[model samples]
Target: MKFAQPLWNDLKCQLQDGFILDTSWTNIYLPNAQILGIGKDITAHKQSKQVLNTQIEQEKLMRNIA
Candidate 1:
């Protein structure tokens, strides 16, 4: 029997309506050469994090300018 290590990655997938998805996914390979996958939508979380980071950087810059 053989198996592969579980895989974890973020991917962009296009939907039928042309809306793209940002996802966090995991893939598992079984001993029989079959694969199982699970995914979660993370577009909102990623966008929120990016916005927070930009705000933090702006705050830092403002502090420096003061």
Candidate 2:
């Protein structure tokens, strides 16, 4: 596949075992053709973001009531 084409992309993917991954991918073709990728476990970050959103909504409601 690398020999045919070179490309890069960033995506969030879920594995077959039901795990999620945040991926950063890159392809290079200069001295040699290479494909590189990296990922992080962002489950905690996602949960934190949801909690923050919920807190923001609650704050908004409280301000309106007051």
Estimate, for each residue in 1-66, the C-alpha lDDT of model 2 and write its tens digit: 445564646577889998877655555555565545444466576678899999999999999999
In order, the Cα lDDT scores of the candidates are 0.89, 0.69
lDDT of 1 by residue, 1-66 (tens): 555566779999899999998998998776689877989999999899999999999999999999
After best superposition, candidate 1 residue 24: deviation in angstroms?
1.6
Candidate 2 lDDT score relative to the true structure: 0.69
- Point out the worst 10-residue segment of candidate 1 by lDDT: 1-10
* Off by more than 4 A, model 1: 1-5
In angstroms, give how far residue 10 of model 1 lies from its true place: 0.7
